[model samples]
Target: MRSASPAAPKQLSLPRLPVPELGQTLNRYLKSLEPFILEDERHGGLAFQTALNLRKKWADEFATGVGKLCQDRLLALDRASPNNWLEDNFWTNKTYFEWRVPLLVNSNWWLALGDDEHVPLRARENMTDLTPWQVRRAAWLVHRVLSFKHLMDRQELYPETTRTGISLRDSVAKMFNTARIPKPRCDIHSKPPSPTVFNAETQKIYIMVHGWCYAIPVYEPTSPPRLLDVQEIETRMRSAVVDAQKRLASGASAVQIGALTADGRDKWAENLEYLLELSPQNQKTHRTICQSLIGVSLDGPSPTFASVGQRALTSHLHAIRSTHSNIANRIFDKPFTLIVDPSTRAGVSGEHSPCDALVPSMIADWALAEGIELAQFKDKEPAPFPASPPQQENWERLDWVVDEKIKSECVDAMARAKAIIDDSDANVFWFKDYGTDWIKDALKQSPDAYIQMVLQLAYYRTSGEFTATYETALTRMFKRGRTETIRTFTTESRAWVLAMLQTRRNLLHHAIHKHSSLTREATTGRGIDRHLLGLRLMLRPLNGEEAALFDDPLFSRSQEWKLSTSALSAGSLFSGTGFGASYEDGYGINYLAAPDMIKFGIESKSACPYTSTDRLKVAIFDALAELKSLCLATDGAAISQSQRAEISSHL
Candidate 1:
């Protein structure tokens, strides 16, 4: 990228927002993370554990927000349509419900990303012919799945204020963080900067396109992420430098002097003003260069991303989120090899559900139906006497799992809703005083359907998030084989749509084959009870008044989340981060954090509580431990030899 400022602008300028002071410091922080990937070999297991702990921490934080909402004293009051109840872009809910999620998303994910990428993703991909809702719904799923992972438990709903005059500080911080590059040791070995053509080298550009997933806390879906996230990334980087300069100029002590060196804060200001401000220009160039490479990781079973609507759907998603999060959390073991083939390390063979963890209970049912009284030690293996037909045709051929009658019902229900959903001039339907009337009865709508409705709402809301793949709801449906799967579940418009809920149910698996193991859930019911409790807690409304909204059409159901194909991503959400940190590292943002988080591998925390100069080394050590724990565990998380073999065959 050219270093010179773009044709120096005129002196007159538009109104300028106050610069956030942590910008450069944030940029420097991101730069510090660059070394993280490079040093991964030095720290793997610990990183994985750290991720788990982090997920727990985030989950706790989310739960705390819900707890606060539950503590509110508001009662049921019917809100009418055309009232302020469902007004667009307003965060009018109580703080426990509104401020909590906003604070979380803003403080954690939004702030960090603002510091790292500097922008919040805004544009919903606009492809017209495909299922725009599915594309955008996938985005919400990404957010839900990722956020769910951070909390280990599904988070309760929280809300946020309108996007107006949003906080730019978080994004500014993220940009400063993104600009950070690795510090070089006195090098015996170093890759010299690629030679510039003579003096042309100076003009040569390098843009770094960094993508990783993090859980942001938001009470509602509005706030600092009002603009397209990429733009925010670019804008925030510049803002960070300016903020750092101002902070250094103002002499803030807590603002550490220099991340690269122990120089005075003044020196940091100088580097920031001179070196950092121009860094984004280089990054922008580098990003352009790396843009084509963004989808490379899509082919394999890897961690993916989130959607914009997650902030809006807040509590609604918590229902299925428990199971969905679990899938995201534990779905990436070596056994995941079955999701995508091993050869490409990116694409799947589509021989089974991309998430095989979904089929366990079904498999167990199949075995039992055949009168195969499975032995306690038996995995997916048959009993001493096998049934007449070892398996059904549906098992071998992915098609016809359900009868034509079931298929017709589902497809018809989905098609009817599609008619209204596809209309171009449809006004967003909502009513005021919904709390008393609609919200009062809204929960009557199936939670499963409610979950799908939320997703559908999100999809219809924006097409700027992802490219579409299907034409009609019935197109190909699920191939039961290869290619992008799409299908119309029902055209009735109200058949208790639970698009992705089935996925949640699907995630509950039984030990199949030699390598699989069964938990106590098969008989005792204790484990399933606990899981159900966790899910209930996650899905419950903040309080009785808020509960009413669950009944309202505007406040109710939508769509589901699914990766169209193996070519997009192998694993889901935190299961993938650009730096490739272990899932334990993901735990930081994956699950709800608890008091134990203080002991969570120090590196996994948003702000390491440790104040030692050796903090970096300690963090690295913790990450290594987490990775090792992953492979060595028999907790049903470790990838098994048999599972890998099975996956490789499909690949």
Candidate 2:
């Protein structure tokens, strides 16, 4: 007999990675995209369509290739003007249609590159045309190369120098000046160079991610992120639930529940009906619905059936009665019963409370039982919850009213929407444990070297716990003469930055121990790489939409696109209120306490995370819309003279 077919390859937790391409794949896509900028078509829609197609191609073709491309491009462009692209000609020319589309597209790719160091190797074998004028320069401008070679190494292709007075850090500082932002270095006590090239080594990928963030300062761009759709939302929700469930099943406590209270059985029926339509055969629609419910419910501490009842509410009983509860029992055996089900006589158990609105610890009973009870988010300082729009949207509305509170509420909602992440050591997984074994993985082996890097500034009052600012810590660093090293940081402080890059990896680290022994910390070397994995998963639906929007020929006109609140979270692209922009702050994970951080600094990718069940989300890239106005050539309001001078000094 044919042995049971080997278990299907485990579904990848991350986004489907595109094949490796040249380091300049983005540069090439920009070249192709550049032509689309000037094609004045007889039909505006046609030009729009062409541009849309170009955007899709760029987004798809160069997405993963962007990290290294951006580092080099920023280095090269830093010479032409400032290293930062936002406050310079790149922004100025785009509005004038002087290949701004290409620059803007380049900006988009730059942000996508993030802080990874391995980017260059992911590109095609040949990385030659990186600085080709055809590919790199804006219209009406000549080419210049101001990257690392001349700055840190002091080597220019041609040597007619006005002054050779600059130091490596001086040149790096210059890149900031050229970009018209505040210079990067502060007045901490200086130390002699490491003598060795590596002063302090961090994971190459983290450094790459860090520098990319510094390049754009784009995460909290003026605008916000976007939302996802029903099916996609359902999938993400289910995945988060599975994440929580695996924890409970293995013996860990649930973090918190965060979702819109389930609609009564009516919504359940509707969702199931929709599924039935998608699968018309004498299908296991009921079983499938229950199956999905089981995944979500099991994540909590209450029996899986209870969680289901809570999410859907009163009619939850009817749905359970009609549903095949056995579907849930297979995963989590709770002696739950639906009054109407033929086999079970267990009637309504208690006054099943409405899934409480997001308040810390409110949903503890039905939500997985874990986490400390925070003060009524209301009772706490109002800082983390920014002022909602003049009008918060009714959750049922389809338009663009994404009340940011909804996200916090939703995250904390079931445990009454609170954050699932916490300060307990159990919630953390120190990277040092992984050793350097990452070198053996085929996917990681052969990473690109860095000429430039990204840095994430995490502000924490130096005490071993979370506090509002990094100012105190910086002062401490200066006092201790350790400002330059991320390594010298105390463990508590390092956890924030680690959380940013590693994201859910910590959760999984805390989790795998309870599920499969192979996944335990002892076997932690078989890793989750959570942040990347979650990003990969979050990207699928976004790419699908990008494909759709890319195909739309009438995409450019004022009427071509619609903006709404839904874009407020995870939609990769949208012209709406910034989706979760506040999340970029250094401690967005504890955002309820500190919202001002959004006004400054590199984003914290770990803040909202994939555990957020809100389908209503968007990508960090959408923030460009807000930043766009700040970028106008004539408008330097956002760029203060002091900041400009600092940027200039580096030049």
Candidate 3:
């Protein structure tokens, strides 16, 4: 009897991402090009009318010619894809895999967790020995994170929905037990055996200490396995720390194989292959890391800085790109790595290929909210021994077989990583001024759009020019959707900047409204950038037969992304979040606009003489203050004295 396999359990259904009409996308693309044409110096100087007409001609030809073919191909792809067209066809390979640079500071995103108040700053300074608080905090975090994973496994965690009750795509399945594996020309992501089930092997996590890697189980053996309690996890961690210390005291040196992960993709691929060939033990160890749930680094104390913002910056930097001394204490390929220092100062650095930072940050928000209570150990000794002696054999140290070739490669990789760390100029700026509440109530503006305007003003004031800018817009409303670009540098925005320069307030509101409209379009899957990208990828290998619109100089210039910016949720549980700049001569700005204040994480390269994080920080402050004054002055008598005084105090 053929039993029609009970119709596959009705899966949570969401609409597929729609491919915007060709004409609509083309029209939007031409409008976006206007800002670039206005500043074009090509052909000795492009006259406004002449350049606009030429661009229009190109757009007309593209809309009817090769562009139509590309659009048709894209539609065909959408029909064939099970979920999202961009994701199934070319998103990851085009956006992430083909980019061969080291992921250390260039591609990975980092988030610094809010401080654990139980462990104060003074207690962390110049700390040499491992404290009980450190182990306990690490254990508690691990337990909480595993609990989040369990909720996900059981589907007990409700699906995240939009304000209108539309379900956002689920990416949490990829956030754990995944790794981005590097290959010759393109990298691939490794998948877990079962995303919804946990076994003894799948329940393990790897820990790195003093440039050494060790694996420990996080689930107890039972008829139905249960997560190890905090005390039990702490026992295992303490045992590993003790073993690492003893090995160091006996003068045993670690090979720093993790350094290979921080090298260029091709180089790392070669080194990894060679190491595996050198010993069967290395192959087993490699599989263990790739299949483990996640990696946690028990790090040493970070160098003390002058301000809390600086301390946050240092903590995030350590998580993303470690110092040369312990550079090998990280596996940057892991989907997420939780880094905790001696004082329980914590942060997460994630590989960007498997999913966006938002996916893991959601998990972090849950884990960070439940801090270990002071009462848990108030009356106990500083260091509590495990009631039962710890099982030392359960911890397996990951050892690598290194020859001269691998050793030399490690040295080169370390040098390259160190250079990047030194060149990064990262700053965490806490804007104590008013935030979303003031923007919505007093200025009557969208907080995100207002911040975009502020960034435009800040960059123009700093560099004396406006360049191509990118703001990420999530398309999670569709099944398996990722992000679409919201091009923030528009004619309206430029006019507003000039108006501000001349103290003319007429165009400010118009510009903000335009940005808000663009943002809405992007979030709804009608953005110009992703559609254009999909069409480009659909093009067949062409020998000078491509669409004229794509070959136009403005097309390439408009996407340079000199100012790459994105805003996360209020982020009350996070100190700051950031990613590297897309261009060497530009800046990367990620911010959190809370109800009462804003926090910004800004990064630039020190080698770029025109870009300075410190200068940008100053400019942001000036722009925000100026905008606040203008808003209040424009609506005089509308702002009450108490509200004015409150805003003044925050500044």
Candidate 4:
């Protein structure tokens, strides 16, 4: 199903992630300080040259002192590590698992799948029966996902490579049958002993319908397991749906055990301990869900919007979080949960600890790439078949026994999740004006760098000051490589923003070029942030003393990440994607630069007085328009001074 051919090399054959040179990291660190120094100069603090000199002095001292010691220890670590020093030592625990927040909107990432052309989006108003199109679509998706897993287990899935033939790390092995298990201080990834090997016992998947959980087998019992056909899976799913409806109609209520996973990590761990202690059946159920191939949530219909743009995309993303009425209908700890609403609108909400979002997104992309009409069941009618009802024994309902205290805690967790959801100001903006095609072909610019400039202009225009910005850069060229931060708010970027405000276009190309250079450095694993992080982490073990370079006030101020952004593949198979803001007053922005349109998913906290998603949207629009005009006017012609002045006035 992958776009690549099967002859690609295996991931284990790739080179190990290397430690950046100590001197190289130090030089880059000093360069990154320029923006902060400039800010201090503008704010009437230290003069620019004096401040730069002071920072350089600190860097030079640290480079020879504690920094050198940390670099030596890091080199030792790199040699000791089998795959990646960062992943083996620091990344998973420090970056994700040790964070105590609930995973719902705070840590999990969501991807909105493009609508199925065969099942058009329709109003869910007063719809009572389950849409056959929805079930069929869900079945088709499940089949494709399992097929992807099959390819992965068989080592047939093509390994991704850079244009220059460098193989990217393959993380598809971690994409299924994995769950983030909560512990006291740090969570752990629970996976099968041989995660990459296909196991018949774990080929079942859990489906949630009407707040009830059902475990249904997805593979036939045989020597070489065969996947169930779409009709078989759909029948099993329909039986679970009908059974759940009947149980609810008869006044049976689930204990809402799933909500426990959405609570704070420590609390969730405590509750899980108590829950397992209550009964062995509960422990078995938990293990079953954890080891399942994947989770599917057959959600009720989503709210309809007037148009299929910002509002519709926003609603769809919000629903995928299972925040309101369906809060208990989700296993948030699952590595990836497939959510399908009525009318077959679907997306994926995934736990962040196992692998990066891009890993699971690859599966989603492949599954959605081919339409249902091309599947084996193409000849079947879109309507539900009148076949005999599924056997009740085919699936088992998972139930939990809970005391009054546990019930009360579930209520508390649900309320906390609701409050967080209510406070989030999130929206999707479809910038249809133009996209990477025009930027690359017409303006001869790197689309990513140009967009980073647009973000700089937008943020400065909205807040009157530039702050730290974060963009994700993949380091998958190495074994077990994950990501490195690309700081987007550089000194050159700041200058370009100022020039844009003054209608001076000379600095535009410089800013974009700098951004592209930084991006290249990050992707090749010469990034400054991760190296500094490694050094800082090594200090306590190497020596008890702290270093002045890391202790400087500007150091913390420069890494606030007020603007957290990332871009995926062109995302023609996805409507949008998003994650929570890194800071309360900041914005979390994810975008897809399609050929002709760019889709943006922006999130901020409404509780933060300094942030407004709508205001930021307007600024983004204005910035894009202005950048287009400026590029067009300056691309190939030399304009007269009066003509330039006229354009500046309009700008």
Candidate 5:
């Protein structure tokens, strides 16, 4: 009953990330400002006008002028380097993954792969079917992922396109040969910024098995890079795993150098220099590890979904990292990583830069779906092992010169990393009652808009007020673009949530439409949030007076996101995906919507008083229940039909 594979999607020539018109951005900014401006401030007309005019004048004059100059600079960088603008402005300058928290602080995702027994998922709410995996199956699944990597490298892999035909295929290139390199020095005054390097030509993967690690290259270097077959891949993996476990059993001292990557930027810089200064071989070894295309960790074992996700999320935070002293033995800062345990064939853990969550989500989704299909080959002819003699050795164990300094720092880094993991809490749950298709087909509403409404209602019911909410809207419609924040806690949304709570059906549809409209604007690259931030970054050094807008009380308050949520629907296969909250007071919720179910991964600082993932889960369910009841009660209502028509017309 399985369907035939679809034809490959054609790549699109998308336009570059656009700069918003100053006037449009200012108007949007003022609209967002309304909720934050107090009743008292509204009556104090002079002060309000002064503040408004000050922001307007700055946006019109300095911000626009400087924004243009920065845009030009970014354009020049892009011209020099195809995707340099993204790296230079955002990833290079702003993303200090090293300087921030330890490795696990804000950069990892634990994913459970799709299983073949569809009946189990159809039956159980707790999803008890996805546990107790075997080592052979796990190894075979890893080979399946490797095959995916081969397709990805050749650019033959299916490119993801939005319903309206925006091709996101180009972003896949970043998923390989991308890594974060540590700074050479620690001092702010002395050390220049160290950037992550991207080199797709380095078609190699780093594998961590047991407590040991090895680098394995994919190509045979036959004029054009020839990919190794699944048999060869499995052979290499088995050998490597055996050798790794052997070393561990023999009680060989671990280098534990991966700990340096988990430390602060300055500390990492200092340790990196010390490491390089130790020997020429050390430098070569370090480069080999940092520049690899991706990492594949063959973890030991786990029994359940919760056990696997928790083990991957927490253990990868500091355990595998600290235990594997050398970067070669540990997972480096690759754009893509596959952390698979032999015990549980289905789950994979991913670690990457904070902003690039979508890349890993894509990889995970593809791997799980493809993995299931490949598993059907259990009764068929097995893939051939090495056809002829293996060309060149693909695996190498790193030699490290570990000292007292390295050991001391590694211990401290592990402690700090563990503290971060300990302070954070994650909750994973599934809303099996309904999903996107149900919302669209049954209720006749924009699924995304409906979900956003659900989030708004959940937060309102829990907190008793609308705090600033941020929903990441993809602006990849433009070339070399990243993301723009959709200010979800708008006046319309607030009104809608209030009305929805009181079962006031009249305002609910209007609110949903308005929310969808704002989301559309952001999607089209007309959002105010990022434009304003870009302008501020451009004008920061030159104008202190205008820069005062950033320092303003109201401006600062609005920037503090109380409810930070982003959606990644990687079909029904992916049970959940999540990241940490940006601020301590906020809750970070990443929701995955399938055809008939929705999975939410709620995360918050355990210390935060206002937010509890458990309570939020309850609120979210309640909100959905209330909304569903409203839809049923008003099934024959004229407004529902008319509003659906209006929404359909806009689409």
Candidate 6:
């Protein structure tokens, strides 16, 4: 199929993400501090008030001086660098690369799209009944990639926009050929090496099937790029899968190069050099896989209708980036993976990093939409489905030395990776009773704020205290901004939770007001967290006591995100999304909000007894019922038992 780029939107119509006024941001910061301030009189006359006041004053003073200066410097940096200052600074944070392990406890993010969208009958009829559905899936994936590339070329792809009209189109590049390469020892104590971003013109992708990898050259040698037809693409992938399966059956030893990619960079680096030593051919193969556009894992023999439990397992494997059992088939940790579990014709998983989950979710949605349309195309639609194409141009299978030592290491690595997957506790809760739209229409509440409040109530019930929770508010509305952590455990939110529990009616309205205000501040880039982070980053290079602000006990405690949350309103694209908890004792909550239902992908550390997904799910439902009852009670109306039963059944 010929490439047809989507028309780019008018650039002037979109506003650049804005930088907030320092004074305004500081005022919002002060308000956020209200929740954390401890009352001295309640705790046996502890000097908590004095400490809180001191910190507040410090924050007030810093906003006028260093914070303002830092903003100016950040602006200058943004202008001076091709990459936005925040983009470079945030991604290069040593804490993310050096301090955190790229394992189950940190770094890895996972998501799966919804299966609700239907494949039209015309597309079904158009499909060659002879070709396997799974094989056709690979072709569809390639078609989606070509479509995305087309949009990227035309710059027609719509950028993410807030109500204020600020756009985050710049971050879209992370969806393609970028790869997160490990540099374990080169500079472990400092910022890890930036991920490798490849030229988009290189339309080449690696296809992984049955623990074997093959390079698929997607673009033809022409002045302007041309993509291969679906039929041609399908034939090549099917042949490669057959060859890989045959090789496996014949006891051809598979070198588990991918396992190293999952390990700590320093260990990976040493092992990689040793691997290349065993056979020089490995280096070429490694480069080929590493540098490809993206990896499409054509998974075999899995049921199409993967339950939330099955998805959790698959997500774990995908998030691992690469493992021994999956072989070193995955090329990049950051780029999107079109993970097709063919037997069930299920969804795809995008590896997080390089970009946020929303971007990939939209792309996956687009891919699915395109697949459906292509399926419906008329048989005489002039689309070429060749019986065969030049085999050499389509695929290449690399050979590797099968050393016993490598084999042993692969087995051990596989065990370790599998343990993390096995130990993981992922509970997918599909709350079909109602979703964001209902909350908005019924209670006049922001869906996000409503959910955050629900979570606060749930956590309170789970552990009679407010933990440091993080809700990622998109700051992409601001220039070079990434995210601002909306501290969900506010005084207002806590009060609302207490009110719901005690049946204290009037406070719920006030809680919604406060929560929505904080959400606005956070989304508009005036949140306390990112501002403080920027100020701290600026203070790092200074040689004075001001540096102590970062070391302050309050500073450390405030940033300790016990519950890391992100809300992706995937529309109909995802039934659920999930990722690893940011903290060992914490939980990672990625949720999808549809019109009538909201599905939650709750992931927690299995080692943490305090965090149970099942308990949290129940608490969430309880909170929802309690809040609705309280709100409805104001009008002297109560939910009927039958309605409650229906809601309970869906959860």
TM-scores of the candidates are 0.16, 0.15, 0.91, 0.92, 0.79, 0.81
Per-residue lDDT tens digits for candidate 3, residues 1-651, read 977766654455567899999999888988898777766643357777789899889888888888888899899999999887899888999999999999987898888887777665565665675556677778778888888877765656653333212232257777776788888999998756663575455778999988888998988776467888777777788788777877777899778777889889999989888988999989878888888888998876555422355665555555545666557888999988888877676788889988777778888888988887645443333464343435656677887878999889988999898898788888777888899999999878899999999999999999988899999998887878889999999988887786675443445677789999999999899899999998888777665558778887788999999999989889888888888999999999999999999989898999999999999999999999998888767743454566545433311
Backbone clashes for every candidate come to 157, 57, 0, 0, 9, 13
Worst 10 residues of 5 by lDDT: 185-194
Span of 10 residues, lowest total lDDT, candidate 2 = 202-211
C-alpha root-mean-square deviation, each candidate: 31.0, 31.7, 6.0, 4.5, 7.9, 7.5
Please write out the lDDT profile of model 5 over residues 169-225, one tens digit for every residue.
Answer: 556555655566656431221111133443333656777654355777666756566
Best by lDDT: 4
Q: Report the candidate with higher lDDT, 2 versus 6.
A: 6
C-alpha local distance difference test of each model: 0.21, 0.21, 0.80, 0.81, 0.60, 0.61
Better-scoring candidate (TM-score), 2 or 3: 3
Tens digits of lDDT, candidate 1, 1-651: 869768742332212111112223222222222222222323453453353344344344433554234322110110222221111112112111122111111111100000101111222233221121221222222222223222321122111121111211111111111121212211011122332322222211111111111111112223321212322222222232233234434764221111211122233233324432455543333222222101100111112222333222221122111111112211110111111111111111111111121221112112122221123112322122112222211111101122344334334423432231122110011111122222115322221222222222223222212111111111011111111112111121111112122111111111011001111111121111112122223344544323221232211111111111111111111111111011111111111111111111111222323222123323323332332242234343454676545433321
**lDDT by residue (tens digit), candidate 2, 396-478:** 10011223443343243223111211110001001111111232231122110000000111121111222222110011111
**TM-score result, candidate 5:** 0.79
**Model 6: per-residue Cα lDDT at residue 570:** 45
> Following a full C-alpha superposition, what root-mean-square deviation does model 6 have from the true structure?
7.5
Which portions of model 4 show Cα errors greater than 4 Å?
1-12, 120-126, 159-169, 195-201, 303-309, 382-389, 541-543, 635-651
Which residues of candidate 1, in runs, are more than 4 Å off?
Answer: 1-79, 83-92, 95-108, 111-651
Q: Report how far off residue 95 is in candidate 1 (Å).
A: 6.0
Q: On residues 369-467, what C-alpha lDDT tens digit does candidate 6 reach at each position?
A: 644344532342323334443456457886556677777766675566656655566666677777777788988777877888788878878977677
Residue 128 in model 1: shift from native, Å? 48
Q: Over all chains combined, what TM-score does candidate 1 have?
A: 0.16
